[model samples]
Target chain A: MDWPTFIQSISNAVILGSIYATVAVGLALAFGVMQMANFAHGEFFMAGAYVVYVFYAIGGMPFPAAVLSAFPIVAALGIVTERFIFRPTRGNVLAGFMATAGVAFVLQVIVGQVWGVGLMRSVPTPYMGAAEILGAKVSWQRLLILPATVTMVGGLWFFLHKVRLGKGLRACAQDVEAASLQGININKMTALSMAISGGFAGIAGALMAPINAVTPYMGHSIIVTAFIVVIVGGMASIEGSILAAFILGFIHTFVTTIFDAVLATMVGVAFMAVILVVKPSGLLGRARV
Target chain B: MKYLAALAGLAGFILLPHFIGEYYVEIMILFMINLILASSFRLITTVGDWSLSHIVFMGVGAYTTALLAKYLGWPFWGTVLIGGMASAAVGLAVVFPLLRTKGFGFFIGSFALGEFIRLIWVKFHFPFGGPRGMIGIPSIELGDIDFYEATPYYYLVFIFTVLCQVVLYRIDLSRTGRVLKAIYADEDLSKCIGINVARYRAMAFSVSAFFAGIAGVLLAHRLGAIDPKNFDVNTMVYLVIWVVVGGVGTFWGPIIGVAIMMVIGEAARPLAEWRPLLFGGILIVFLTLLPGGLENLILRFKEMLEKLRSAGESQPAE
Candidate 1:
């Protein structure tokens, strides 16, 4: 293609990849530690966006403060779900995951009922104008996502490596029984992972609130993509999710630009199938599932 | 007594359409179709698989029948057979890559693969007709009895339903069914006993898809229209709700689940928008509190009745 279009596509790809990474990393972390998969993860992302809507747009808070509010609000949601749903259904991965469908339905209804489901909520663009790069103008709203992703993902990396609780999470993921014997509270680690997962997903949603049409049903599409990313990245590997996120983000953005959005999703799904077949353990995954 | 109950139930089914309004008659047709779908889905569950692609395979059957009837002017019988076979082929393709994975991986893999097939329909407008899907499908015409009539069409679906159930029921009772149950109970032990684990899993999945196709064919002909939305993830969730609430251990479980859910669904038609919320709540409650589902509830009642009877007999002897 032409130079400007190519440049725009590349930037778009990066932005998309970063958003995907933020959403997917949480999924991988929760799954890695507890083998607990949340089918309503897209709803977690939706809760994040709604957090910004309630805090920033309606409550008159600054954009940064609203975005920050999304994390704790949605993180609390995650912890609640873990304690009530995941903890009780522990060991039966299918039951816990399937039950999340109930969680999704409940969340959607609650959001829709409160917001009035008839019309989509429009959060005005907080950051006006675009940042020109290589003759291609990228909106400031979009450009903000890349750094936000790197910081969050990088922060997660440091926490996992440097922090004692994070290291305990890794230990729990590697072997829960062994980690518990070594004095790590299994329940605490699982709850922590879910909180982080919910927080990141919420952050991604908060960041995109202005760009996307904020509706109760918005999570439907994103959940499909998140699942594909988590699967391709290896079910529970954070590193694999990040790597898979970029790969999928680039694939989705480029394909949509070249062809159409629907076909791009098809291509992205086909890409996931290939990844599953080629590297069942995922790119950086150690766990088989 | 059981045989008499079966005969009476059959008589009710045959005659009830005459007494009901056209709307209720149509709903019964759909209820029957869902019964087949739920039962076939339970077949896969028998092998301990909870695939999210079951509805997609049903869509395959619907699309196949729609196209074959629309373009080629094929007869109803021929198109239905082609529909089942086509879904079976697609089912095999989906089950292939998923053979290596089990449990959660298999569940997600099947979902991704199912979505891929659906995307093909949504992306290409050639024969599949993209998102809007196909329309104006010809109803099954057998001599003078037109299937466009609600009563006639009910009988048409009824026959197919019985046939599909018979096959499914026989399979569940046969040696093959026993082996599949064994596999679900303990896959490693079944493998140790020289059972081809992948082969059986793949076979059960495809066979399940085959019956789902039969249901799809009935749906396409009845509705005379089909769309991508007809077989989506939400629809799949509803399918899961039906199976989970009914319990999957027994053949009749899905049937009971469908019956109870369909009744609830119909009764809640006024609160249509809130029904998903209700069903979702029901799913979580049933899973957490009543893991064995409605069938388990019935089985427990039976045991209690038998114990009461034995107690009465012992007291009288004493």
Candidate 2:
């Protein structure tokens, strides 16, 4: 590849990595705090994009404001999913996880019915100009994702490390029985973890609204990628997800540049399969005692 | 008395196809295929592993049959057996990487592997026929008997379904099935004993996939076409829903679940796009409130009846 093309691929990979990090971080957090593997996380991301479409494009709100709006709205959705679906089916992790597939179906049908599922909704590019770096031209809309991801992920790091509730969540993730006995509200932590999970996924979706086609079924594709990322990063390890997301993003972007999207996906999945075989605990995840 | 009920049910299956319209007959054929699919799925779950790629193994059987028929001109008998073996081989390969992971890890890993296989079909247009899938698959024929019509095909599927069900039922009753159940009950304890957990788990998975492949081949020949999309995750989720809603504890649970859901699906035809919403609702409700499924409900009723009968007998003696 030429210098410009190589640089462009690098920039694109970074943007792709940012979006993936934002999406997979929430999934990792939820899985870590509780064994709640949400099959509907991609839908949460899709819901975020729609939030942007509604508030910024249709409602004529500021793009940033609309993107910001996605966090709380979809976070509420995460809380509801926890309170109803995950809570009732708490003891059996797989059952709760499978129930989210039902949630995915319901969300898809509702979105399809409410919005015209025919043509993919094109959210207008809020930031139009391209930024040049190392002789590679990148769109401002895409570049914005890097800073946004860093901020969101950085914020999450801070929250988890410094906040009392965040410590409670970590404690629960470590040992539910011990955490509960120590006067931590397990219910509150699970709900909070899901809320943060939903919020991160929502923002990721909002960021990509203009970059990709917004459709109800869009979640179907990314959910596979997200699962691959989560597994490779280690099921519940946020840092691992971030690292794996970038690795996968680079793999996806470079492979797509060289070959096609299909081949890129195959390679990514192959990488994940190798990871599962070599290190089941993940890159950063601690093995269970 | 149980034999009489079984005989009557078998007779109804045979005779009912003749009475039903062509469309309903086709539905029955599909239903019987699903019955095999769901029950075989139950076989794997007996070992406490829920593979999200069960449907893809069905696709393995399907694409195998399609390729064999299209190129080699293999007849239905040859293709069905080969398709099943191919599916079993693929299932074993998938479970090989998966035996280390448990619960959610296994589920996600299986999905990734399944998607990898499915993508191979979508990427290569040479034999698998890309996204549009394969078309114009040759239908089954037995010299004078052309199995194109609804009734003949229905009977064919019925025969396969009954055979598969009997074999599966026997396995469930055998020492092997007990070993599988023991693994599900407590993996550590089972391992501490002489039970080979990984080997049994792998066996159950491949065997289950073997039957799923048969179902896929039967469906493929009936439809006279095949595609990658037909064996995607959505179909797998439906299978999961069927097994969950029906209860996988017993041999008949998933079958009953499929029967009930298929009927509801047929009735909900008017709902059109809204059908998934109903299904989704049913899945959540069943998983949360009725985790044991329809079979669990029936088992409860049977227990109640037994309790009442024994009480009456003792009261009369007193």
Candidate 3:
């Protein structure tokens, strides 16, 4: 590949990695805190995109404002899911996880019914300029994702390390009984974790809405990618998720550049499978007893 | 009494198509195909590993038969057998690496592998027809019987369903099935007892995939066309919903689940775009409130009836 193309690919990889981190981080958080693995996380991401579509595209709200709004909207969805779906099925982790598939279906149908499922909804890009970095030209909209991800992930790190409630969530993840005994409400922590998970996924979707086609079933492909990221990152390790997400993003982009999207996805899955065999706990995940 | 109910149900299945319209007969065929799919899925779950690839295995079978029959002009019976074997082989390969993890890890890993296999079909247009899928698949031809007719096809599926169910039921009742159940109940304990946990788990997965392939074969011929989209994760999730809603604890649970859901599905035809929402709602309800599924409800009802009978008998004695 030429220098310009290589630079372009590297920039694209960064953008892809940012999006994957944003989507997978919440999944890792939710799983860490509550063992509540959401199968509908992609749907949550899709809902976030639709939030941007409905607010910025249709309602004529400012793009940044609409994107910001996805956090609360999808976070509320996460909380509701935790209460109704995750809470009741908590004892059986698999059941709780699988039930989210039902949630995914419900969300897809609801969104499809309301917004019309036949064609993809195109959210017009508000930032419509390209920037020259090195020799490669990258879109401003795509570059915006890098700072947004860094800020969100950085802010999350601060919250988990500094904030009392975030510490409670971490404690709950480490030992539910101990955390509960120590006066942490497990329910609240789980809910909070899910909220953050939803919020992160939502913002990722909102940012991508203008770039990706908006569809009800769009969650299908993304959920697969998120699951791969979560598994490869170490099922419950937030740092691992971020690292794996970028690694997968690079793998996906470079492989796609070399071959095709289908082969790239296949390569991604193969990479995940190999990782699973070598380090089942993930690249940086601690082994669970 | 159980034998009598089974006989009557069998008789009803044989005669129903004669009375119903051709469209309904076709629906019944699809229902039976799903019955095989769900029951085989329950087989894997007996080992406590719920695969998201069972439907994809069906796709494997369909595509296998589609390629062989279309290109090589293989006969129906030969294609079906090969399809089952092909799916089992693929299932073994997929489950091989998955042996390292359990629960959530296995679930996600299987999905990735399943998607990988599916993308192969989507990526290759030379033989698999890419995303558009294959059409003009030749219908079954056996001994001068017009297999294209609804009745013949229904009977064909019925025979396969009964045969598959009987074998699966026998397996469930067999020692192998017990060992699988033991693995699910306590893996460590099963290992201590000299059970080859990995071997049995692999066996169950392959067998399940084998049956799923058969269902796919039946479906491919019925539709006379196959698409990559037909075997996607959405279909797999629907299978999960069936097994979950029906409860895979017993051999008959998935059968009952498939029957009830199929009926609900047919009845909800008027709902059209809203149908998936209702089914999704049912899945959530069953998982949250009735996690043991309708089978648990039936078992509870049976226990309640027995309690009522004993209570009446004691009252009379008193």
Candidate 4:
């Protein structure tokens, strides 16, 4: 491959990795805080895509406004799901799983009813034109994703490290009852986690809407990939997920460029299998539950 | 009374072909296949871990049988057994590492393994037919007769289904079953009590994979073809739902759940795209309201009816 192509491939890998990092980090946050898997996390991503599709594509709202609007809309949905479905199913892991799985199906069906099944929606790019970076041509849209993801991750780190509520969230994640004793309302922390997690996923979805085929079934592949990433990174480890995402992102992109997308997926999965066999807890996964 | 009930159920199954229409018979055959899959899923759950890859085991069995029958010209019966054994062997290979993980970790791990297998199936076209799927799998032949229609195949599936259920039921009620239940209840306690938790869990997974293999083989024949899509995550989700809604801890929960859910799925066919919505709604309701599942609900009703009858008898003196 030429230098420009190589540079482009690296940039593509970074962009893809950033998207995965954003989505997987949300999952890590939710799992870290609640000890719940949130099977509907991908649906939240899908909801974000639809939010943008509705506002920017159909409703003619400005792209920035549509993207901003998706955060709160999907976050509210996440809060509702946590309060009604997850809260009631607490203490029963299987019940939580079933309810979340049910929620995923419900979201898919609703999206299908609104958008029609098997039809992909087209979302025009908000900002058009390419930028040159190290002799490689990069689309502004793809370039924006990297900084946006970085900002989100950096902001999240700040929130978790510097904010009191963030400390309370961590405390709840460590031990819910202990956190409660410290006057940190466990329910509120969980709700906050869901909202932030959902909002993060939604933002990722909105950013990728122009590039990806927006369909109800879009979440299926995305969720599977996210699950693989999350598991390979360690379920509750945000840093691990970020690192794993970049690794997987490069693996997938390089393989796809060299061979084909189908082979790339196979390679990615094979990589996961090998990792699982060697380290079941994942790359940075804690040995504890 | 239990024996009588079993006998009646068996008799009804045996004579089902004579009474039902071809279409309904096909449905029953499909139900029987799902019953095996669901029950096998429950078998794994007995060990305190649920596998989402159960359907992939079925896929393994199906592809094994299909490839052998289609390419090597092997007899269907021989290929089915070979397929099932292949699935079981794969189970044995992965069970040790897999059982090491607990709870949701194990679940996700197994699912990833399943996805890996599927990707291989999709990537390698010569052997497994890749995405287009394998077609023209020869039907089983029984001495101058071909069991291609719904009736004969229904009987074949019914017999295998009963055999699998009986074996699983025996295991569930045996000492091994007790050990598995103990593991489920408290793994650490079971380990302290001298039970090799990993060994028993592996055994449970192997047995479950074996039955899932059988179901896959039957499903491949029933559909007359096998596709990568047939054993994907959606099927895995449905199998999990069946096991959960039927009552995972109970021996007969999967049977009831598979029957009811498949029937409902078929009945809701007219709804078309709305079928999934209806299905999801029903599943959510069941998860929230009947966490113990349909089997538990039936048990409670039976207990209440017995109490009412006893009250009526005692009121005679009053």
Report per-candidate DockQ: 0.72, 0.68, 0.73, 0.58
Off by over 4 Å in 1: B305-318
| Candidate 3, residue B65: how far the Cα is off, in Å | 1.1
Q: How many residue pairs clash (N, CA or C atoms closer than 3 angstroms) in each of the candidate models, in the order given?
A: 0, 0, 0, 0
As for candidate 2, its clashing pairs are none
lDDT of 3 by residue, B58-127 (tens): 9999999999989999999999999999999999999998998888778877888998899899999989
Candidates ranked by TM-score:
3, 2, 1, 4
* CA RMSD per model (angstroms): 1.4, 1.4, 1.2, 1.8
Q: Give residue A166's error in model 3 in angstroms.
A: 0.7
Q: What is the TM-score of chain B alone in each candidate?
A: 0.98, 0.97, 0.98, 0.95
Better of 1 and 3 by DockQ: 3
Best by DockQ: 3
Docking class of 4: medium
Candidate 2 structure quality by residue, lDDT tens digits, B117-208: 99999999998889889998998989988798889888899999999999999999999999999999999999999899999999999999
| lDDT tens readout by residue for model 4, B1-318 | 999998998899899889878999998888888888888888888888878788999999999888887788898779878888999998887677776677877787788778778877888888888888888888888786668877888888888988888888898899999999999999899999899988899999998898889888888877878888988988787877777678875888988899888888888899888877776777777777788789999999999999999999999989
Which of 2 and 3 is the better model by DockQ?
3
lDDT of 4 at B281: 73
Candidate 4 ranges beyond 4 A from true positions: A287-289, B306-318
